[model samples]
Target: MEVPSSEELLQFLSSCLSQIKWRLKSNSKRRLEIDVLALCTGMRPVVMIDYGGKMPELQNRLLSLLELIREGLPVFKDLKVMVIEDMIYLINVRSLPKFVSSSLDSEPELFFIDLEQDPPKMVTQSKESNLGMQLRSIQKLFSSTFPLDDSNTDTTTVLDEANSSQTSLCIDLSCCLQDTKVTIPTLNGWLLDYPVVYLFGTDHIEEAIYNLSTKSLRLFKVLVCRNGTTEKDSHLEELTSAI
Candidate 1:
């Protein structure tokens, strides 16, 4: 989660400007990379994205561009804000690339691109932002991406065992817990307030059971039970009974 050096971000902005001008004539996909970077820069939120085979060239370009910014823009080093929009991938068990910074006030700001009508704002190179501020911001971003506890040895072992099984699957529960307690019931109610729940799983089922047993059932919702393997059967039952 390295914050783009002010010079780096600015160079990206410059490259984006070039693309924006060129793509204005033809339909272009900017939301994923350039536009994402633009929106992230404006909000001063940590930008997160994964590197993939398709974008090796772009990744290298971005890396080089960042080095350029480090040399060019000293102001970005201290800046304490940025925006990030990207996917997450677990390429390695121990190390991964991700932006992990907290929001300025513990409440991060994010903006999703509107591909239909609202377009990204145009940015031009300027000396308005302070280099130190930018760099600090980048540091904050890198700190955010810093690794959390790697003490899930048991979980990793379970996952490894599950992966070896034909039916076993490991669903990411890290995203579910705020402080380790799954706020599934409350979250379910929140979701019931919405029109749909596209993702469903055993954890949600566990939550539903908890809500029902507590006489505080949020709403009636369907939970899809994707087939589980023998290894998962025991864990699933434990999760099921815990609810």
Candidate 2:
């Protein structure tokens, strides 16, 4: 079976997130020895692609994977999302009890996917979906990281713990600052600069503002605009705060 390239994974994530919050970047620091990392709106995210746990007999490799995820706990700001691909089929065929035992955390965004499909999307239905949903308990984590956006004026919804001493790294609004016309040299530079993102826009770019202001499930942290969108088109007062 073929695997989706890193580029493909980025695009897939962009579609899921709406391409606003993250941009693909290389693992120069090799944080967690990850093959791919992306800059997210309020946090940095790491994606482990095309990885299936080692054979049950190879306990060492499996243990290593667990340690890597555990060590990265603080680095991810408690928001680690793992999107599995064809590996689900492998698990279904032979129950890997240990790997399942390891990922049973309250936090971390867990997704089940079938790469063989034309578009390579998340698995929403069937037997595997139920198991995946049980393991992905993302709410337990986000309940602590993000706060309820009761008002439209709230732009940065980072929780207090994120700013506390426990979490050394905190995402800020500095990334959106621009007076200079910065030139990104290459694709690598683009990824490094933009990183991986999830965008939800109203008109593909500004469209997200309307959705974000009204709805609570914001997929993006930083809002992207091409022609300088303003509150004229959007009804919410907080629409201006997204960028």
Off by over 4 Å in 1: 1-44, 48-53, 78-243
Report every candidate's CA lDDT. 0.30, 0.27
Per-residue alpha-carbon lDDT of candidate 1 for residues 62-103, written as tens digits (9 for 90 to 100): 444344433545433322211121222111112211223232
Native-to-model Cα distance after best TM-score fit, residue 84 in candidate 2, in Å: 16
TM-score of each: 0.26, 0.20
lDDT of 2 by residue, 1-243 (tens): 454443444344334323232222433222222222232222222222223333332223323333343353332233322212121110110111222232343112233332223233344323343223322332223222233332422232333323333222222211221221121111111112222222211123333334334444433333332222356743221111111
lDDT of 1 at 140: 43
How big is the RMSD of model 1? 21.7
TM-score of 1: 0.26
**Model 2: residues >4 Å from true position, as ranges?**
1-112, 115-122, 125-131, 149-164, 167-225, 228-243
